[model samples]
Target chain A: MVTLKQIRNSVLIALWMMILTFPIMVIKVNTIENIVIWRWMNLLYIGVGTVILSIFWFFLINRRKLEPEERKRSFALKGKIETLKGVLAKPVVQKPLYAALLVIIIIFPFVSSLYQTGIMITALMYVILGLGLNIVVGLGGLLHLGYAAFYAVGAYTYALLHRYLGLSFWVCLPIGALSAMLLGILVGLPVLRLRGDYLAIVTLAFGEIVRILLENLSQYTGGPAGISGIPRPSFFGIKMSLSTAMNYTYFLTFALVLFTIFVVRRLEHSRLGRSWVAMREDEVASEAMGIDITRAKLSSFALGALWAGLAGVFFSAKTTFVNPASFTLWESVIILCVVVLGGIGSIKGVVLGAIVIILLPEYLRAFSQYRMLFFGLILVMMMIFRPGGFIPAKRRVYTFDKAQLEESD
Target chain B: MAAILDASQVTMDFGGLRAVNNADVHIDQGEIVALIGPNGAGKTTFFNVITGVYKPTTGDVRITAPGKETESITGLKPNKITEKGLARTFQNIRLFQNMTVLENVMIGRHCRMKAGIAGAVFRDRKTREEEEQVVADSYAILKKIGLETFVNELAKNLPYGAQRRLEIARAMATEPFLLLLDEPAAGMNPHETRELDEMILKIRATEKISILLIEHDMSLVMSISDRIYVMDYGLLIAEGQPKEVRANPAVIKAYLGEEFNA
Candidate 1:
């Protein structure tokens, strides 16, 4: 059943893979002596490996083609798969799945190493930031390229307040968030009228301005050196050690992520949320529908800034350091990437996007210099295959049958 | 009958090119008036001026709400004009294409509903009750327009005629005292136009809402409209009962080579 044409195609694929890997496998740099060396054994191993992999792949693909009953079997298999999916999707099954996930997350830090916990904390911080940006870009359809400016404002607000006024983390949290919200409004007012690329450019400039101001105002902020020795958030007046502080901050960010999810979920289903969707779909028509476009845009900006502010406070407490270099245009771009890579309007997608974007780079550290190249390749692949993100938002569904049943009058 | 909308000396000049020149139009309570003209007669431009889409170069647009004093609404925002009980539909159907039919109507009730961000996030009892009321009211409006069957369908998925009706249903959700419709029967077939005529009459009779429409469908206008105003080159040339306007020489000249048999 293995056709001559199929075998030829597999051989060609094997040849391509061998050619692609030849340079990497056959040549090596002698870092210590600065000399080039040839590795014929490695090249041979790669060529053999590609040949074996292609043979296996072709065998799997050709097996179904060989069996005439495979088509009918697959149709039946698909039906069974759908039934299994329905069962798994039932509320009874889902409730337990959620509970199990919660239990695992609670015990994860205790079981995992300290380094793993640190990585998790970073991922969770991005999750909060991603959710905040999702409100503006995803729901409100406003492209903000300078979201990290608000993040910086929040971090510095807490840093300066604790440094000058001797305020505790608990006291600085609200003030830092409010300050960021105020700045969000101030920056949002004039630029809200501009649409698309123009709005994006103005916001990009605003972010750079904040960074330059922070750097030049070194008498207060420490310039490139940054402020260090910022106090950790104490738990019930007890000072935490390095490991304990990691766990505490992890739990704190976990709770905040849950809160963000809850608030965003509610907003998505509420009147305000609907108005945001309306604005996203058609701005002029939304205004004619009696929605105050100015109010909606401003509120989205403030709310988005509020979350970023909270995340900034947590960032300062965890690192116990702050600097202008820490908040950059790159930071804003990475956070935006997370939101876009996650489905823009979906809460779950944003969370998954944050985890993938934050964790994948760390895991690829073994490749060191090649990790960024690999990351770029993966992102390109994902964009080509799943442009809607890891988890796309669900389309709206209405049950007219139920309404008809109830409308007997 | 008391005038629900009164506009005097309304002129709109877009940098030396006059779109509407000194056009005076009015709608009385519960009256169905048709603004019929050939293409580019400033009928829609005049409507935009009244609905606050554009501020006329020189004009005063006043709305007299039932039992309320008349007030100038010339420079107000479109949302503000909607709040003052005047709502208009676009010539092209402007329903939110991605949203459900029910949601499109519920959005029309936005000005009437009072739930803000805090209320929405907290889910207070009052907000919950108001939200329920909005759903019920929106459903009733859909049913009135015979669109209850497609309540869950996206606006883009509906047929052309249904999309047009959905626009009117959405405008009515604001509970306007006067509805301004720009070419409601533009692409409708004869059967659909007949249904639209009956629906417009029913809206006027049951809701007591005045209708001012810009239409090219002569049969629809002649059959349903109580009065007609003919516009030509930004000027109001004739205004009278439908029969008189149809026979007027100025109206005939304005509609020269256009169909007016209906």
Candidate 2:
């Protein structure tokens, strides 16, 4: 049933996709040996993958033909995902299911190995960072390319504080957050009059400055060699085994993730959250609507950076190390990717995005080298194909259906 | 009647170009005023100055808020002006497109509501009650604007005419004493334009909110406006009752030359 037109279109699209994904698949660099391995088998995988994708695309086009012209622009993926979301949306089904999920997460470290728990902690930390950046980039619609700087500030707050002032993890946590918030305000103030690319460049500059400062100031920050032998967060000064410590870090991160989710969700639906989104949508119009544009933007930056700081503190404690290497622009990019790839302005999407971006490459270690390549492709694909993202945020709607109440009666 | 809004000797200059000359416009308590001008007549610039988007080079913008003393809002931030019960819509629709229709209106309630991070996170009784009222009031605004069906829909997904209406509804949500509409009927058809005229009158009649609109649609302007101010090339050419302004030779020669007779 394949027509010449369909076959031609499919081949064109498949080949285009192959070309995009092909270069990354072939070039695998072995960092330890400093040599490149041009893998030919990836060509085979691409060949097969493109064939399957073409078939899928063919059917998608056929189905698309039945829809109206404007509607035909989107793929069948939208409808399929919408139905899936609808099924999972009911409180009756979701309440118990989320509770079960909570229980499983609570007991996960108990059953898993220390290695698994360690990576799990890292992934959860990224989730918190992703949410923090989400407030700035997603909801506030400010492109922040310097998120890692705040994270570094948080890490250093703990690292430098404990070294100089003899502070504990519990004591430095709030201090680290406040310090990052101070930096956020400082950054936010100058960028108040800037928007779009100008703001992006400024934030990028800020991140690089923080990292370079940390690296150059060897006496304070330990330069390229980074500080080690930092103590893991003590559980009430109980001298615990390494495995217990891993489990403890996992639980702490898990708790923070839940708290972040709760707080972010609340903030997203509140007056301040509304103002942030409004500002993002149209600053002039938002100002005319009586939203204090300066306060809203600053609060978003400050609050967004606070989460990153908390995550930063959590990260250093979990790894028992602090360094400039970890807070690179690439780290900021990945966190931005998590927010963008998940769905900007969506709490659930950010969490899922963090896990996918952090955990997927871990599961497929062979493709670890190609992680950034895949991320770039995923971001491009998401922007073009599904701009709403993997699990697009459901519009928060207040139900005033008195009919439903009466129907229950 | 005391003017709700008063802008006197307003002049705006951008570098070497003078966008608005020494102009004076006032909205008295409960009046529908029109600011009509040709393209680049500096109508929007004048609006911008009044809304605090620009600091007039040598003019004063003042508002006499209900139960509050008169305050000069010249060079004040646009948010500050809005806080003083002045809200405006754009010539180009500037809605929160990614957000829901209801949410767009709720943003108008932002300055009116008081809730910070603590209230948002904790949802205390007062915050909870306020949140409920926001929803109720926003929904009511939507219902009044005939956008109840599209309350949950994204603002981007709305029809063009409906999007324009949503902007008005959002402006109304701010509970302003004076609502400014800049080219509200620019892209709308005649039927939509007629509907907008009715809605403008409804707003004035029901809410007791004075309005100032800049428009090219003379029919909509002449029909609804109690008073009219005509501008041409940054100059306020004429001002009087609609008929008086419409008949003025300067305004007729500059703008309404072909259309208005008698």
Candidate 3:
């Protein structure tokens, strides 16, 4: 009930209707200009606009938020049931949904022929990273600002392997993943005892350190100039090199997306996932309940790193370039924003956030020079208005009667 | 009576103060023993030291079970102590407020559940079977404690008396041979206290689990505990059956007060 998707669709329809009818307004404006003098119409228009603006502003400012809103009440009941059953059922019902979504995703770019295909691929990558981070951040409740470090490590590993060893992309992928995980564990050891903000700040420092090393090690990483002309992957020796476009890359992206989804889905339903949540919720109690906090946190960090590394492999392959610029703190922040803007532990919400965060800016290209400003303002407004998320994780409700029990007690 | 737990020359100092000093305690099998003391008498401090929250500056606490299972509980973590047939409730109730009553009890069974992450995540046949057994056993404990209905309710949402019972229920779920109850009747009214007295007696008789209770309610303590130990200024002043300890001059002076003796 009152889903964000429905709201988006409705808003799109309203905007379209306004645009379609704009010509009629243009004709009326011309007729009015002819009927009145040009100077007087301009003055009249300004005066009328001021009055309309004032009135609209007054209503908006003075509007009373009704105590018992009908829309909210209608949604609340629906929301409770959905959260209890639908959200809980996600892991259980993933198969059919995954199959349907897989078919749609595989063919989506061909059907739309839109630049949004790129956005989808990017979102899918972020979803993979978020799932990994969910293990570290959401489950373990550890703040990891250096997740991009793992991504960079993965990208570099793939680049080096392909460049020097002439290793196949298939062979290098697992190597990249392992490299990232090893780095994750290395980062984890020093800060395993830290908690909350301290852990975050340390990780943030680690990320910066990695970036600086990549920049300073000019001979190894090619420094600020970066590594270029990385090989494009071929499926059965058929590369998309002749197409002058991104056909093979798209398929590669789709396969990666499927793989990410499968891994994340399995991990979420795993015991490690529960342990992370348990640690996050109550560390002392979790320990008392026989869950090992240290192992849980490390596992979360490593899993998160593994996902980032995998994404980096694809990201480097798609771009055919590795640079310090691509793995900046801002990239980490944007990925974090995508996770946060989607609900942190919520898979669907994160995916939706990634799509919107990426596509909304692209769609605003008609605004030309103001595109970035408009995008920034939209992000601010969305955060202010719906901090829980555009699509918040459904909250579970439980009800049980205890009158007889009280009497007995 | 065979001693299940023996504390020898236990002494704990906190910066400038001696919380528990030169203390000796022996808890025999199949007996309910009460550790009674005045407000500043350090009964809780002794319990904490024994439970390994604070390692005693000098002392050894030994728990000897059947088959010569002897565990020196000193310097071990609270959970470790709990694992060795000793579970404790806090002086100020420390139930996980957000968790359901059933879940809180299930947490006690955490140590018992042999299924690791793989088993739980997959809900494999063994995990499912273990979960079923835990649920069944937890329900039985809840029923025994008369909190079966409030099983799904959040622990914090329960009425005060019920919350106290839930605390006991949670400790029982740990399957401890010796339950350390910190002020079980602390805030209860007369009726609730009476009910608790009967409940403690019933647990003693049926479960055959010895109880070590720290209580301020003298009436309940005198009526239930097979033996009582009174403390003042971190020293054991008196120890015996209720009537003898009640009449002891030192206990009267330290805890009961001169007015009660008069």
TM-score of chain A of each: 0.82, 0.84, 0.74
Candidate 1 lDDT over residue span B1-117, tens digit each: 458899999999999889998989988998999998989999999999998889999989998999899899999999899999998899988888888999999999999999888
Model 2 chain A scores worst on lDDT over the 10 consecutive residues at: A64-73
Q: Pairing residues by index, what is the TM-score of model 2?
A: 0.89
What CA RMSD would candidate 3 show? 8.8
Report the C-alpha displacement of residue A15, candidate 2, in angstroms: 10
Q: Give me the TM-scores of chain B across the candidates.
A: 0.97, 0.96, 0.95
- Please give the distance, in angstroms, between residue B119's alpha carbon in candidate 2 and its true position after superposition: 1.4
Cα RMSDs, all models: 5.1, 5.0, 8.8
Clashing pairs in 2: none
**Which predicted model would earn the best TM-score?**
2
DockQ of predicted candidate 2: 0.60
Task: Extract clashing residue pairs from model 1.
Answer: none
Which lDDT tens digits does candidate 1 get at residues A1-409?
Answer: 4567766776777678767887887789999999989888886777677766667666645654644466446467756876787998899999999999999989989999999998999899999999999999888989999999999998998899989999988898899889999999999999899998998999999999999999999999988788988887778889777888889989998998999999988887788888888888888888888888999899988889998999999889888999998889999999998998988888989999999999999999999999999999889867865788988865456454466436622
* Interface alpha-carbon RMSD, every candidate: 2.0, 4.1, 4.9
* lDDT of every predicted structure (CA atoms): 0.89, 0.88, 0.75
Give the per-residue lDDT digits (tens) of candidate 3, residues B1-262. Answer: 4588899999999998998879888888888999998898899999888777788999999998655667688898766777777877778777767566776677677667677545644667877777667766776788899988787787778999998998888788777888889999989999999999999999888987889999999999999998998888888888999999988888878854677434
Q: Per-residue alpha-carbon lDDT of model 2 for A42-93, expressed as tens digits?
A: 8778867787777776765565556554443454666676678788888898
